[model samples]
Target: MLRRLLGSPAAVSGHLHRSLSTHCVSTNLRRSLSTAASSSSHPPWAIIDYNTLVDDSPSSWAPGACFDPLQPPRVSRISAPPHLLRPRERPGPGTNLVQLLTGHVTAASADGHLLLTYYDIIAEGPRASWNQTADMEVERFICNPISGQLLRLPYVSGSRKRICYHRMGLLTQPGPGGARFAVADIVSQRERVIDRFLPELGRWDMVVGLPCQPTPEREMDMNQETVAFGGRLWWVDLTCGTISLDPFSYRPELRFVHLPTGSTLTSHIHTKSESAEERDEVAKYRRVGVSEGRLRYVQTSLHEPFVLSSYVLDEEASSWALEHQVELKQVLADGGHECKNRPPQIAVLDPMNAHVVYITLGEQEHVVAVNIYQDKVIGSAPLQNRYHYLLPCVLPPSLGSSQFPETGKKGDMEAIDVLVSCGRHYKG
Candidate 1:
């Protein structure tokens, strides 16, 4: 489990969808830093990535990983340099015709190499069993984020039907003595429309209408991102559903569960102290549950900052649905949709502690930590666009806790983080 979680190519885009809107949220955080600085006020740079949340001792999670208090930090008003420009125009990534696609996503890739993009493309169609053969074949490509090195898996030719690509994550599984990179493609065996491929194995396979679980196949209507945390993969199903993938399992699958009803969440909000104006504002934003268990999608018609929603997953369902009864308000902070929707690309790592989501934001070539634990934007920095976010992953035997530094402020020794502003992509 430790090594399998660490090996990936890097920078695969994944993310969740917003409620009551048509726009998409993604995490390839590309910043064109060379462009002129605009009037737009950038985010604050004071908070350190690691905080001394606990007073006396260092955070329990601090030792093996880094709670680097002295790490270089970014000043509030300063912005990093711009990104290197590409030819002004040409065939860019994701612009090709025969590409694997869906509108919504949650987490893109667990490691850097095999991206685990997600979609609520499933519709409320009908039921299918893992045992009951739907007779489908699915296929998709696992492409390189940079060179576009694609490994195409052969299609089940002349099958008279298409397969569906459910979801995939780059896994470093314990193969005898060590970890090996593998793409765990959750494909629907039914003559599913989506197909998938493994670049490492040089193999082809079918994707499907449903996963390996026993839930009835439903047509998902929305888009969502795929996320990796706690040694597993997770995403929100179109109907505000969240799915968790077991990283340790051989035949990878999501144990489905249901989320709290939207009304259950919104109705529970105490409107008592709210002013009429505030009440009106509250109406715009509600804490509606998204994933099964305790998580909710806290979205608003009003665009203030980001609001955080969180959940717990029940590991025993066949189809995607909510699980537990313990409700958590979690982190209700201000977040612009930029982190999820605005990235040019993204990468993820289990990092043994909590999930570390890396997006190269700005035209500046920087990685941004938009939200951690649902509330705070831990840190940000200017980084190479070509650099994969997967390279720094740490496997579990988890060194310590996954939380960021307890001390919100950078140490006196060095700055804790940095930021980069993006410019327009250069058309050569």
Candidate 2:
């Protein structure tokens, strides 16, 4: 299907196959840095990407961050430097077209950093014919949008090639020199392993192997976003619960915390049978995030007398404490919307405000901010895309200088791409 749609990978443009270089910052980064410095802002923003194909519209390729702390939440797009979009090192002059497929805003940290996965296809050519399937390149980046600084992470090697399945997240630790960060890749299969990448070390270290599964009854389905809270990275399986580990610990210990009692799926047989689209639809009603320095889980009941329930994890990582429950029907009626049957999609948890949550209501997906405590709709705006991965990020007080640090070992780029049904091309 991808081959028929993309018309043989040779259809890519020159901008896609360019070689990567060591430039501190591009003109775009400098402009963004200037803009961020002057703005007085709130802590968290709703970050999402336009997963649609790239056409003549430039905004389609960029990821957007929606700021709702103040009234009328506004959204702005974040653009990547041209060099970061190309191959880290040139394969050859004969390299065929490498289509920039899409960008996934996989995770975010407390320090306003984002973990991005760029999907690209290396067209089959004489030099690139080692594989038959699309040469999907695993390009992982730690980007601070406010600082306009970006760091391309080194690829994890020594095992089989890295695909898009491994769950990853960004972990940040502030130090005297500057804010240091690490990438936690939770590789789960027959066995689960944790890989940590610190810039100072310049390579991925296989930290430890989990002694046992998070649950003995069924395997974990961790498709939701990973949360960075309390100096640890929390990988969430929305239907099940969450598994957290402090990536910085020398002897990392994995801990499991299930969803609020009665929220977890009792059996995996039904969940496993649902298609990916079905799973995404289910995610719209459930989410876990950090708010007011505590881990919170929120979900909307599927049946009527529709209710939105929120829970906060206890300090000891033992269990979840029920926080608030807002009746969605009453809220909708108060807001003057008559569509009682339309279920709302849980967009994001207000990282700074424990009582407020964001949701996309109706078919238009109008982004609405709701205060669960008061059952009031405070702010809203229309979102262009229906299917999106929304991430809540806290922008720092001041932007950091654009300093592209050295990762010691030369970086490697693996080429394998999957083209979705989207009709346009997107360059990230």
Stretches > 4 Å off in candidate 2: 1-44, 50-72, 87-98, 122-132, 158-161, 212-216, 270-272, 338-340, 399-428
Q: Write the per-residue lDDT of candidate 1 for residues 342-399, one digit (tens) a residue.
A: 3223322213323223334334255555344444446655542233222232212211
User: Model 2: how large is the Cα RMSD against the reference?
Assistant: 8.5
* Candidate 1 similarity to native, TM-score: 0.35
Question: Where is model 1 more than 4 Å wrong at Cα?
Answer: 1-112, 116-168, 176-178, 184-202, 207-217, 227-235, 243-254, 263-306, 314-428
lDDT against true structure, model 2: 0.60
TM-score of 2: 0.76
222: Cα error in model 1, Å: 6.3
Candidate 1 — what's its lDDT?
Answer: 0.28
